[model samples]
Target: MAEKIRLKVKCHACGYVMEGTSKYGKGNYHPEGLDFQFTAVGKLVDKAGNSRVKGEVTILCPNCETRNRFDI
Candidate 1:
């Protein structure tokens, strides 16, 4: 099963708020955040079955339309 994570981003240049979602596993995608495109791959799993995700996401400012790089 894939886990769905919701994200909210604020534009640094114009201060626009965007909401989006990223899904883990199952190769399914639903565009939630309107201002950014994020792609995360690989997983870090613990002994207890818990996992930590690491990925790079880019934030697109609506006003300025600038792409900002971030790690999550």
Candidate 2:
């Protein structure tokens, strides 16, 4: 199996950390303090069968309700 892409984000406001993974053009973040998912727009995978999704995602922090921007 191909290795999953690991995602980690830290909130500058409350210092809360978010973690997730990207595989097959789908992104899934832990729902502990956040609930979110995104699908890659065009191509699902690259020539190597890896996720080809690349973009910016904005999410509100669950702890302080601060808006955080992330690049995936």
Report the number of the highest-TM-score candidate: 1
State in Å the error of residue 32, model 2: 9.6
lDDT of 1 by residue, 19-45 (tens): 677666666555654635657767779
TM-score of every prediction relative to native: 0.65, 0.51
Worst 10 residues of 1 by lDDT: 29-38
What are the per-residue Cα lDDT tens digits for candidate 2 across 1-72? 323445678888999987766543234433333444443344456788765545555667778988887666
Candidate 2, residue 10: how far the Cα is off, in Å: 0.3
Supply the TM-score for candidate 2.
0.51
Worst 10 residues of 2 by lDDT: 24-33
lDDT against the true structure, per candidate, is 0.69, 0.59
Runs in model 2 with CA error above 4 Å?
A: 1-6, 22-33, 37-51
Best by lDDT: 1
Clashing pairs in 2: none
